[model samples]
Target: MAISYSGYLNLPHGFRSHDILAFHDRDSEQTAERVNYSKNLLEKGILWQGMPACLILQFKKKQQVAITLLAEGGKDVSELEILPIVQRMLGLNQDIDDFEKAHYRHPQLGTLVKKQAGLRVPLSSTPFEALAWAITGQQISLAAAISIRRKLIKALGITHSCGLYCHPNAEVITQLGQDKLHQVGYSKTKAKTLFNLSRGVIENTLPLDDWLTQQTPVEEISKKLIEVPGIGPWTISYGLLRGYSWLNGSLHGDAGVRRGLQKLLGLESKVTAEEAEKWLAPFTPWRALVAAHLWMSL
Candidate 1:
């Protein structure tokens, strides 16, 4: 049996739902089962509290301003749970006034922000899901990583009649061995990391779910995440920005980000991680948005 609900949500100022959905268009890291942006609607499937869920969203405006979300054909989710999950997945709950204020002073970031206002950090459905994506994308191009993850989801995720899928939970991933994972496009080292992360979370060794409500520092969480095999600084920083909305961090080692920075800063040579850090310093607390906009500038 499936449970569902539909309701209006308050959207943040300048929020363009399609532009946010476009972020999902390029990445295959299985951020959602299916994410489609059209002229009138945004449709997606996500695992909500470990259950497969599909949502059809539309913005409504008049005397009352709101966005509509219709949750359909999923198990074990209440209406209350759906909205918050959607909010987190789409970054509807984030207030970017501070980010805008902080970035307004930076010469390049100010123009970037103006060109791409209300572009949220585009969070994953949960911290665990976010970490899974980071693990899959290590040492590869974003498109290739996403392709491998898509294969993983096709092999293990739940599906709908319309052919959309829902990403599996850690419990499900833990059951698959290295052979199965490798068949689904994971390299040996990446496969090991996936198994370790899934089993660690399942056995309470990772305790990623604890960060959902518990007030934990981002660096503390990163420290724990990188302790897992094959995890590294780039994953830690990217996960902080995408999974937990920790915006103060920079995308120091990302090749694409470095290229974007070098071009935006008018540099002839490549921007090293150290140089990226120095350039990112003035942006300070707004690096998250800067990175997001920088990627767009590319």
Candidate 2:
């Protein structure tokens, strides 16, 4: 079922239609497909067995959230539990200022990045899913990772509509043995690691939600995430930044990030990850935003 709602939000300075659309695209990739863009609007286009279902998101006056849902003919949008989903999808209840100050800025790096093309920081609902996806993507070109993920989701993940699947939950992964995972293109070791991580989530050996909400600090969250099998520091940091919305974590080890930084700095030799951190210090809280800009710039 599909439904839509629209409203306004009061946002911080530097908030633009593009910014909100970028956020929506990042946050909704697992649930939606082909978010079409224009000057002031984001149109989420969904295809169920090649039929069209659309959701249009528009922002007015910075602080408002506007939603519109389009379903197939005769489908009852009124019966769907849509408002809450829209709210969550828009992150309407979350504080945008902190996220803005920490991640979005208008400084040197920010300016360069904003001037670049097609850069975006994508987000996921669950840290576990983000972590797993990051692992699956490691050392592989993005296209390869995406193809593998599509197959993986088709094999083990559940879909709300045809060809639209949510990231598999811990329980789902726990039920899919390593052999099954290997069939989805995971190396045997990677499959085992994924299974172990899923077990951790299902058995509550790892308090995923608590850890995300814990007052222990971002560094601690990164550390704890890294302790999980198949999750490295890069994956953990990206999860915290993109999944939990931690503003200060810079994805230094990412090759894309490195390439972006090199282009930004005009360096002859690639900057080491440590050096990249120092270079990114100026962006501070908005490092992730800067990172997004950098990615877009490239």
Candidate 3:
């Protein structure tokens, strides 16, 4: 039997529900997240606190949203547990007022912010998910990364009762050997890194979930993550931005970010990573948010 719980959540100011819902539009396969545009709904499969389930979010009138949790085999989840996960995934508490006020009048970012206001850094369902995605995206183009991610999900993701695949958890990934991962589109080095990460999680050495619970400083967490092989600054920055909402992770190494900066500055030549980092230095403490704005500008 299936079980469900329903509740209404108040939308935060600057919550661009439509834009957030549209995030899954480009997914070549429905592995985890799905959106029903005409119904203003998004369905995502998640493994929360050892329970695999599906969450359905319905955008409604009056700036409030309704959420339903569907769990197979009658597993139950309380409102307290469900609400926080929903809040985090939706980025409800990620306030950008200070960022907007500080940069609303800047020479370059100001216009982008005005045009793309309320853009919060949306997170993966869990820190592990973010880490895996970052590893998958290393040194790859966006289209290629997405294709590889789809393959990984299809190969290892858990299938929910609704037929939607939940992104593979660390334990699940560990079940596959490097050969299998390679066949699923992961490069040999990336496959090795994935094993290291999964083993770290299983051995409790990484303690990602603990860091989130304790609200550990981003620097502290980054230091630990950087020690892992194949985990570089770009991966750490992107993962921290998406997983922990650490807004200052310099994304200057990202091709899209650099391209966005080039376009924003009206530069005729491609911007070097060093140059991009220097240019983005002024937007300290919210560099990731600024990067998001730049991406939206593209």
Q: Estimate the Cα RMSD of every predicted model relative to the unseen true structure.
A: 2.9, 6.2, 1.4
lDDT of 3 by residue, 1-298 (tens): 3666888999975478886686655585667888888888988887655556788888886788898988766556788778887788777767698888888899788989888888887778788988998999998887888888888877875778887877777888888877888998989999999889988999998988889889999889889898899999999999888788888989999998999999999999999999999988988988988888888788
RMSD of 1: 2.9
Instruction: List where candidate 3 sits over 4 angstroms from the true fold.
Output: none
Lowest summed-lDDT stretch of 10 residues in model 2? 44-53
Superior by TM-score: candidate 1 or candidate 3: 3
lDDT of 2 at 251: 77
Q: lDDT (0-100) at residue 200 of candidate 2?
A: 82
Candidate 2 residue-wise lDDT, 1-298, digit = tens: 5543333445434444464465545533444444446546655544322234555666666555566656544354441345543443444444444544443354446456335422334455456766677777777887677767767776854544334454576677788888998998988877877888778877877666667555457776666667766777677666666556665677777777888889877899987889878877776666665666667667
lDDT of 3: 0.84
Provide the clash count, candidate 2. Answer: 15
- For candidate 1, the per-residue lDDT at 190 reads 88
Candidates 2 and 3 compared: the better one by lDDT is: 3
Report lDDT (CA) for all predictions. Answer: 0.72, 0.61, 0.84
Model 3, residue 26: distance off in Å is 3.1
